[model samples]
Target chain A: MAASASASAARPLAGDSLTIHVSSRPQLAMVSALPRSSPPTWRLGLGRPARLSTRSPHARSVRCLAAGGGLAPEMRATLDKVVASHKVVLFMKGTKDFPQCGFSHTVVQILRSLDVPFETLDVLANEALRQGLKDYSSWPTFPQLYIDGEFFGGCDITVEAYKSGELQETLEKAMCS
Target chain B: MGVTKEDVETAITSSLSPSHLVVTDTSGGCGASYEIEVVSEKFEGKRLLERHRMVNTALAPHMAEIHAVSIKKVLTPAQAQPQPEPAADKAQA
Candidate 1:
């Protein structure tokens, strides 16, 4: 065991174990579902995707739910960029119109009633994304809200914020700029 | 199977040692949903978001089995005392 350990230790750079996910998978199904161009390069640790960042008028943020957790290093960067793209982003169980979960629906209603122009990503559509979000936010629940690139909270918090008019205040701040 | 109200209370009590706790089985007959109200000294100076996060972390072991968790309220003992909300709170609204 010691001999093997020493032999492997001699292997330089092989033990980085950074868990980098250069998704050379060519055809990521989730990207295809997106309305606009979501070139894999944007997530390929490149600046070209930053160009997609500026070019994304409205469609990108709505569908920009990247996977997290085990395959998160690259996905995390992508998610950061995605969250930054929108003033209000909701990572929920379903879209704005039809929410699969009650908690998600409640959040949707709150956002709608508040008249906050937000984007929603249905987590049910992607297994990796659904699982990754639990790890990413550490909240372990759906209907997670992000305002101004910061995680706001889940349904209960949103409800509380809405009642306190804090949600309105926060949305105003986010939308103002 | 999902967790019961007792299990949730036990978890929170052991982890946070809250001064007050109320766990409601909002899942009706099922054990999937719960509404939690907790008051802990640990919440002193913490924002509502952090308090809720602490409660959620306490229940992390059972998160997969349990479905929805609505943290109805989280207060420090001082805040939980018999008193009206501060005027500044109303001013924000």
Candidate 2:
């Protein structure tokens, strides 16, 4: 609590609680609102209304496929750097020649059909990168396609984008850069 | 025999100690495509990509049996919440 005061002193609050500290506030409120004898839901109200933040907890359960790589914290940072390293990168299940997963194969096919040149990371070989990717993209599914070092979407999104020619357009822009 | 769902769960639970965990059999029964959602302290400070990597690593032994693994979400218990609809998804309708 004391640390909060120091932090608050540095930045003025737009609301009762500082926006930066909003998440922490909910956790704290949830702690104190606990009545030793009351029902759990009563405690729920006192805390910050559960936020449906962009990052959802259940995001990873979107598809039931096994991840292939090991993603350590440092490896995660490295992966981020790597994704940012290239203009176009895809964290796919397999490589361009032999896609291990159907979703991955779909994206590879789409990329090829578009005549786009992109780098692919085979998560199967490395464990750390695979696990780290789930968190980095905030996506629950695989066949994650990145353009200009940014996550475009998963296989489904890629397929749709390819159909509409958006995927080709985006890749064209990336390749030129 | 390929890796089983129970094997994947055990690896994840043992590695991440997630507060919430959901494992789905996308393969229908063959154990190929699978999806998982895990909320754990291990995910704190890590980004979405990294969190996925962690889950992937935990399931390494079972990877051969898996075909398409989709991670719907990975978050710290504190960060865990329902997902927001993507802007494109909203626009498409």
lDDT of each: 0.66, 0.57
Q: State in Å the error of residue A137, model 2.
A: 1.3
**Cα error of candidate 2 at position A9, Å:** 34
Residues B36-88 of candidate 1 have per-residue lDDT tens digits of: 88889999999878888889889988887898888888999898786574532
- Cα lDDT tens digits, model 1, A8-106, are 232221112212121121113333233232222322232122223333353233222232222233344345554665678788886777789988999
Clashing pairs in 1: none
Q: After superposition, which runs of candidate 2 have C-alpha atoms over 4 Å from their true positions? A: A1-73, B1-93
Per-residue CA lDDT of model 2 for A1-177, tens digit only, reads 111122223122112222111101122222222222322221112212222222223222212222212222222223334455456677777777888878889888887776766677777765445655665554545778877656777775676567768877877877776
How far residue A131's Cα lies from its native spot in candidate 1, in Å, is 1.2
Off by over 4 Å in 1: A1-71, B83-93
Residue A3 lDDT in model 2?
13
Over the stretch B1-93, how does candidate 2's per-residue lDDT look in tens digits?
A: 656678778999999998877777777888777777677999999755466668877876676567667666577867655445343243234
Q: Among all windows of ten consecutive residues in candidate 1 chain B, which has the lowest summed lDDT?
A: B84-93
